[model samples]
Target chain A: MGELRRYFDDIELGEEYESPGRTVTEADIVIFAGLSGDYNVLHTDAEIMKQSIFGERIAHGLLGLAIQAGLFTRATQAYATLAFVGLRWKFKGPIKIGDTIRLRAKVIGKKETPKPDRGLVTVQRSVLNQRGEVVQEGETDLMIERRPRP
Target chain B: MTGSYFEDVPLEHVEETPGLTITSAHVAIYLGLTRELAADGGAVPDVLPLCFTTGLGWRVPKPPLVVLAFMGLDWQVLRSVRVGDTIMSRSRVVTKRPMRDAGVVVEEREVVDQRGEVVQRGRFTYLVAKRTKETRA
Candidate 1:
């Protein structure tokens, strides 16, 4: 429906993709706090956060990671993904409300397994805010299904 | 209760949270908010468990640290989580490096299913504020 599936064989190192942007919202932070049980005053108490170093409430670092995953999935909707294996992520900066964030990802590494069914692909991802500053960056390893025989 | 100050936190400290069952509703809400569809067989999405680590950390009986900022994360996913799986977290402080006014604490955290099998594990680093006279009172 979106595009033909991009199997493991179809991928190449150095390939790059940019995802659509989504703005962070107040409700997003509030709901995440409730669901995650992270009622840190930095997120819940605006008056208190007004005096903190950041000077205002900020989105959870993990929230930005979760959104990046969704954005990447939507960008390459036809990826033949099997599972997410691991990641090394850094929270470089704060994500404030109403900041439109986009994901820029590049294929950095690939490896084949003993079996021919699937392979691993490593992607370097940067979550960039509206001003073009990278707020979060990471490398994620994914297992992708190989192209099926006809 | 107040959060754990940098100077007061002890190394090798450990804590665990109660089990939380992953329901369809929880999964749906997460997917809906992220604008993603449900996974095959209603399996939980990959990042959901990672997000749950924060909640699980909060649920532990021990007081949380006075985190000024989240520094980084190194995560590994070993098993898949499904809608019916009940998960818990076990976290241990692995390292502590004190700075001028703040300290960095690294926690080795693992998420386990009802059977106590490790579903995922990772090290989370946070920047915590130092305990001061103002904070003491």
Candidate 2:
């Protein structure tokens, strides 16, 4: 199981991995709401939702994204990693409760920055639901090692 | 349709001071509201992150897109947000740019607290539906 963890020396650009889908939960939403202080009526208010375009309360896009932490962390936390240089996200549809989200991640590219200790690795991420529809898609620039270390 | 972008939309002003104060009631209310609308169950605590992220999202200078999900979250509870901490938010649109991918655009939302300290920053991309629309907070 731990084989999923890839050290800096292991991964090559263009390498890809797929993970099983996970469901979003109510408890997850509630905790995030309080932590960030975002209370949009559409996200929080049912009545407002009914009066709005969606006609119902939908999962916040970020909730689907946050679930990625569990999926990606499990895959990479064993390896020493650094900062998330940057991420690009796209919201195609609502990720409602009870929906299953599958994570697809791939190492697209790597660049050697001026720093001798670290390099920037670009990884692509996709959150797809049960029907095989992609709800969220993006690429992230993450930190990796410049060379294998003892 | 060919149209102008966020760069063309232009920033009328950057509000540095805290525009609003957040309360526990606000948190609870938002949680309850989202839960009721979503028709999901369990206590409201689970939904706090959703509210906080959205609250922080709106407070972002001009969110090109909303939080769909977060890839990583490292929350520090140095100070528990209380009912009367007078939570204040100062949001600024940090960056905006076009993407190479077909049918998409991206922007960054950076939010700070009352002390002019950063609280949250999110880089999100959205599919543009309108040829042109007024983009503002």
Candidate 2 error regions (>4 Å): A1-5, A75-77, A146-150, B1-10, B17-54, B57-108, B111-137
Q: Per-residue lDDT of B18-61 in model 1, one digit per residue for the tens? A: 88898888888788778665557569987898888788888766
Top-lDDT structure, candidate number: 1
What is the Cα-based lDDT of residue A46 in candidate 1? 89
Q: For candidate 2 chain B, which ten residues in a row score worst on lDDT?
A: B36-45
- TM-scores of the candidates are 0.96, 0.60
lDDT (Cα, tens digit) per residue for candidate 1, span A1-150: 424778899999999999999999999998888777788777787888888898999999988998898898777755778888999999999999999999999999999999799999999999999999999999999998998878
- Per-prediction interface RMSD? 1.1, 9.4
True contacts kept of 2: 0.21
